[model samples]
Target chain A: EPEVTQTPSHQVTQMGQEVILRCVPISNHLYFYWYRQILGQKVEFLVSFYNNEISEKSEIFDDQFSVERPDGSNFTLKIRSTKLEDSAMYFCASTKGVSGGSSYEQYFGPGTRLTVT
Target chain B: AQSVTQPDIHITVSEGASLELRCNYSYGATPYLFWYVQSPGQGLQLLLKYFSGDTLVQGIKGFEAEFKRSQSSFNLRKPSVHWSDAAEYFCAVEDRGSTLGRLYFGRGTQLTVWP
Candidate 1:
């Protein structure tokens, strides 16, 4: 089965530095999403992307954060300034959106563990 | 706001024993429910989902779930669990019934299967 893939399984960066997390969603998927999980905590949604634009975002996705589909296959999340609170497991997910039908399931990647010091 | 509750934080079961993890949700409308499992150092894996259906949904890895609308609960069950089934399980809800919507996830239940 095809699955979403994320690069740099672990990332360590200094506070105030910029960090970019990369992901390659399933080839045929149309809707992409970003989520984060604090250590030993529930997973929280960050943003959802479709058609190269943001469909929805949470308060955690503030000014310092942005997402890009630079290529047809790559979806990237960038944090302009990393903070201690930013350390978490960032997961990339995708799904084949149902067309005119009800809906389909979303798949998640292994996630990139971001550590800010 | 939509929220999910997983009452059990941890559970231990002997190999080949039956298991059930509880989950409840607070959503305004017809909810879309999903069960995901995460092994150590791995991402979340989908087990099953409940949409408009017969209420009893079967999923991979010998897992199943029942959606009880009256109780606002979607609990996961395994008739016989293996050692490999030890992992963290999460129940999530998507109120919008689509991937475009956000998924509110429960805190998760950690299952430990003893050999």
Candidate 2:
């Protein structure tokens, strides 16, 4: 079963530094998403990307966050500046187009653990 | 303005005992509901989802969930739980009409299956 894959399983960075979390979604998937889960908190949606553009974003995805599909398979989330609160498990997910009335289930990657200090 | 509520923060059950996790949502129309599981330090895994007909949906790992539109709930259930079933379960919802496919997730219920 083709699954989403992310790089840098664990990352430690300074509080003010910039960081990029990379994901390679399933080859045929058209929609991609980024979600985060702070320790002991519910997974929160960050942003959704389609056609190489952002479709929607949450409040938490403020000025500091940006997503890019630099290549066909790579979907990357970039944080301009990190804060302690940015430390969390960042997950990447993707799914086929929403049609056919079939629920296009998003498949998640193993996640990249971001640790800011 | 959509949200999901998972009332139980943590639940414990003995091995081979039946299990059920409650989930409720606040949505105007028929919402797309989903259940996901996460083991400690792991990413989320889709357990099941409900889109339209046949309120009862079967999923992986011997799990099932029923969508009750009258109650605005989609609760996950299992005939018998194993020790390996211990994990954090999350309930999420997305408005069918929304184009972004952005999902709203609940706080989650941590299941502890005792041997």
Q: Which one wins on lDDT?
A: 1
Error of 1 at A58 (Å): 0.6
Worst ten in a row by lDDT for model 2 chain A? A97-106
Interface RMSD, per-candidate values to 1 decimal: 2.9, 2.1
Please identify model 2 stretches exceeding 4 Å from their true place. none
Candidate 1, Cα interface RMSD: 2.9
RMSD of 2: 1.5
In Å, residue B73's CA in model 2 sits off its true spot by 1.3
lDDT of 2 by residue, A1-115 (tens): 7889898899999999999999999999999999998988878999988898888888999999999999888999999999999999999999996832575788889899999
Runs of candidate 1 with Cα error greater than 4 angstroms are: A99-103, B97-99
**What fraction of the correct interface contacts does each predicted structure contain?**
0.62, 0.66
- Residue B66 CA error for candidate 1 (Å)? 0.8
Q: Give TM per candidate.
A: 0.96, 0.94
lDDT of 1 by residue, B1-115 (tens): 7999999999999999999999999998888899999998777898988878689999999999999999999999999999999999999998585448678899999999999
lDDT of 2 at B106: 96
